[model samples]
Target: MNAVTNPHILVVDDDPDLRDLLATYLGANGFAVASAGDGAAMWVAFNERLPNAIVLDLMLPGEDGLSLTRALRAKSSVPILMLSARGEELDRVIGLEVGADDYLAKPFGPRELLARLRALLRRSHVLEAESAAAAAPPRFGPFALDTLGHRLLRGGQEVALTSADYELLVALVAHPNRVLSRDTLVDMLRGYERDPFDRSIDNRVTRLRRKIEPEPAAPVFIRTVRGEGYLFNPRGGQP
Candidate 1:
């Protein structure tokens, strides 16, 4: 269960029946539920009140799920779980690549949806708590981690960070100049169960490098230490 009380969830789908069902089920399960029929409606609901998490459908009219996901990711780090009727692997990959945190195929059980949603919420809440628990906000290079606000600021401008990105960066910043292995990072971030070949950590590193490093192609802030793992260079000159 999420530690946050009555976390609001926005459900965006064209199917009115499905929308009502999810709203009812999620509301019954202690979530504040809001429903939207399409992309326009979703945006209206989103602007009126930002949701704790979003349940987006892939095949919405006007703006598709991938497009909406990209737009949302550009603005906020809110967790998004995308739903699609087609269970194709390519679709799932595309969805994830476009910034959907999790993907679910149609014909899924309500219990399974609840479980996945809960897991995402749990991770998000844990990240917030960790930030709030920090004794003092950490600073590195041109960035200042606003632990109390749960935000990353560079030159007073807030930088958008996903839950995974924020958690990974927090872990790296906490232990500067140390080579952290993939397994160690996964454990530290409380990452979802991943296969042996999962490159989630590496992907997150690339994303963070793009955001913070002077040269992402040759990163100085986050250096790859050969076969060991990654090392954070807080001073950020030569890695």
Candidate 2:
């Protein structure tokens, strides 16, 4: 998500009434609003212009909210507030696990939504400011990996990245062109305590590739070495 003076918020829900309510309320509260009926529409709106934050409902006609959340989080760090009609504990947990920044049950007030949106934007602003203040970020292709800022920039525009993604990127860029084993990467990631069956390193790699690679399917930057782990190529193309 790039910096904008008037924060844009995208609301994804099947309920036309709810969408109207939010558009009116958020617009009145000084926010630019976009509405999408489902995951397909959400993507169209997203690709057209990335929103500062997304309010995604849990249930949709196809590709439920959790799936959408995971897909979005894999590439972008846009703040997501998931809404579920069920209000089940499992649903909330799953939503957050899939990368929702916050969750709200159905029948929520517009004012509360506005408040949560503001909070997310506030946090995002602080992050942007920190990234802007950082000196001498490393360049790779069209990207500048801001180690101090804990973010990534492409052509001077901020590309949203999670802390875990940033850490993984830092490790990879620090040892460019070297294949680092998964175990080594797991150890390098600070505060990442793992289970015996944990494969978060691989997951993080996939997520990172989606953001940085021109073609994730045939990655040019981060290459997977058969039986060896992964290698980051700062210059891109074959290692």
Tell me, by lDDT, which candidate is best: 1
Candidate 1 wrongly placed segments (more than 4 Å): 132-239
Top model by TM-score, which number?
1
lDDT of 1 by residue, 1-239 (tens): 12578989999999999999999999899999999998999999999999999999999989999999999999998999999999999999999999998899997888878877876876676566565546777788999888777789999999999877888887787667888898767655654455667778899999989989988998889999999999998999843
Model 2 gets an lDDT of 0.83
What value does the lDDT take at residue 171 in candidate 1? 74
lDDT digits (tens) for residues 129-204 of candidate 2? 4455466676788998776766799987899888888878876776677888886666455322346467888899
Q: Estimate each model's TM-score.
A: 0.59, 0.56
**Which parts of model 2 have CA positions greater than 4 angstroms off?**
1-4, 136-239
RMSD of each: 10.3, 14.9
Q: Deviation in angstroms for 196 in model 1?
A: 19
Q: Scored by Cα lDDT, where does model 1 land?
A: 0.86
